[model samples]
Target: MVPRVPSPRRPRLPSGRAADAALAAVVLVLVAVGSLRSLIGERQESWETTALAWALLVAACAALYACRRHPVPTATFVLAATIAYYLVSAYDGPLLVAFVVALYTVAAEGRLRMAILLAALGLLLTGAGTLLGNHDVNGVALFMMTGWLVGVVALGWVRENRLALAREAEQRAASEERLRIARELHDVVGHHISLINVQSAAALRRLRKDPEGGPERAEEALGAIKDASREALRELRTTLGVLRQVDESAPTAPVAGLDRLGDLAAAARRTGLDVRVSTDGERRRLPAEVDLAAYRIVQESLTNVTRHAQATAVTVRTEHGPRHLTVEVTDNGRGPIPLGGGSGSGITGMRERARALGGELTTGPTLNGGFTVRATLPCPAAPLAHLPGPGSAMANGEPPRP
Candidate 1:
């Protein structure tokens, strides 16, 4: 037959002091019941005999109460008292109950080796007392002792299993939270930085072309600032939506790519900078990530030219092929490359974008007394079949003559 599962005992309050009080009261009532039975002529037992029995019962119950707070000490006390009582008289109900409770507590909460040692000691003492008291070696005593040992072992196993399950649940919850945070950072932070890099380059180009066109160039710069700030706000809202129960949709805008290079050039033109864009090879559709990376590299390079190059004209050229897409932004400006200025986060941001797209980017002085930024991006073999027509080239795939 399957053993019935025991209910989990209520946890004792403040070192089991309250549980001890309750156990003490129950023990007194049991003693009173036995005493009253003897007094009412319920049996032929003598007054002294009845009084001794009540005293042993009360002592055993008191030890059981204290066991919750001090398992080892209380178990020791119960063992000694029960053995003494058995030697004087014989085995009884109260003594058995107290001993069993003490054994279970020690096995569940005490160190495993210590609990085993204590159980061995208790068994030895019980056997010795029974032999000395002339109690018969019967099957009943053996059965009772076996049952107590089984109960102790089972209680310890159940407690360990419960603790293990709780720990596993906690770890799973922490892992899920980390994944959610990573997704939010990637989606929101990456988008805004791309927009900022694009607009800044456009402003710098206008400043170089028409040195006297200060008012118009300032207006273009202000517009770029407004567009970037608005994009940042929208990205922030999308990230915050994750915490709310309602499902707010992400904003849909045209993904910046090669098709939009004219608008990019126009923004620079508004700043009084003469900028030209040219393309070659088939303008086939590209992966969204690859397209975004190419656009940002060109944007950041041109932005740098407008800010630092101080040149009259800038050129952006794109070449698509079966194996790769190449982008080059060059300017005939007479300024040294500012590697140590710490004036901007633009260059670091550009490198991060290219790395994200599985591509390489390089920026430095060109051989013809100008600055050039070049990136070679790998493309899929199949998409090269659909490259754009010849008419799509910016300035027919050639830089404007200085």
Candidate 2:
């Protein structure tokens, strides 16, 4: 199996408040020195008048520090200071900078509806004030205000859209987890329950024939039932452990691997099936997850044979390659054999396990009047690793054949 790529860490952004302090300091210098108007226009106003403008500009810019914590109130204070300076002062460099930043914060952090209403109200008030005072409204003033206001709102909208998409992705991941857990519960319990039913019916028939010998047969049936119950509970607890929040001191049970196949085959033999197992190449170790998946496929296949297939013989085979491994389980059963028919949920589950590892599974009725399940699982390695092609002979040097 290919190892999963680790997720990247989120990028860290510099604090906006740190930048705000610098911006506020720059605004203070420009307004106090009265040098801003030299670039925009000549500031012929007196030093006393410039000092008043400086006071209002400083108040507006200072409020920016609190915009994130109390966005609406801080923005309102900045707006009032801007209007006071706009109405009387000849310079507007610092006030304009503070005004745009405050509006963006209001939209980003606080109630959006209130921010929108305030923006519209300020626009109308500025237009009306300009008209009443007969100031020029068709020059650089109109274009600058329009661009600055619209840019702030657009940035806030983009941020909101990204947050919405992130929330939706988290919800979808949660739903998929629920479906996965449900499928695990079904597979673990369903096979054991099927075995229990078959054993119980046989015991009933024996009991109705002779009371003395019947007790012995019934005792055997109860023993099988107890074993099945314990197995189901153990597997359920092991699989469902992921859902618990509490930490555990007990060690987790190791997952079942291909090494347990001998015991599995022996169990099937007890259930009246003559089973055989064979390997085609060097039996090197597999990736942990791939080994577990192969074991489950073999176990499920044998359970299907006992529950559905009427035949008395079966075969389990494995072929190991340098870059991949193939597993097959075949039984002499009739076509469309219940859950083991190679077309129901059981086959779908097997295919899912293979596909998750970039592999595939195919199931069909063999020409020998039985059903066959075959799966190929991949193993990933570095680019430098040399592996033989599919048509090449095994490491044993035998000629390749289909």
Q: Would you estimate the TM-scores of all the predictions?
A: 0.44, 0.62
Off by over 4 Å in 1: 1-74, 77-91, 134-137, 182-402
Tens-digit lDDT track of model 1 for 71-182: 7787777767666655554334345556666676666664455556667777777676566664554447856876676668578657756776877888887875665455
**Candidate 1 — worst ten consecutive residues by lDDT sum?**
389-398
Top model by lDDT, which number? 2
Per-residue C-alpha lDDT of model 2 across residues 347-401, encoded as one tens digit per residue:
6677777887788899889898999989899964333224342123332124457
Query: lDDT at 66 for candidate 1?
Result: 67
Output the lDDT of residue 201, model 1. Answer: 62
Best by TM-score: 2
TM-score, prediction 1: 0.44
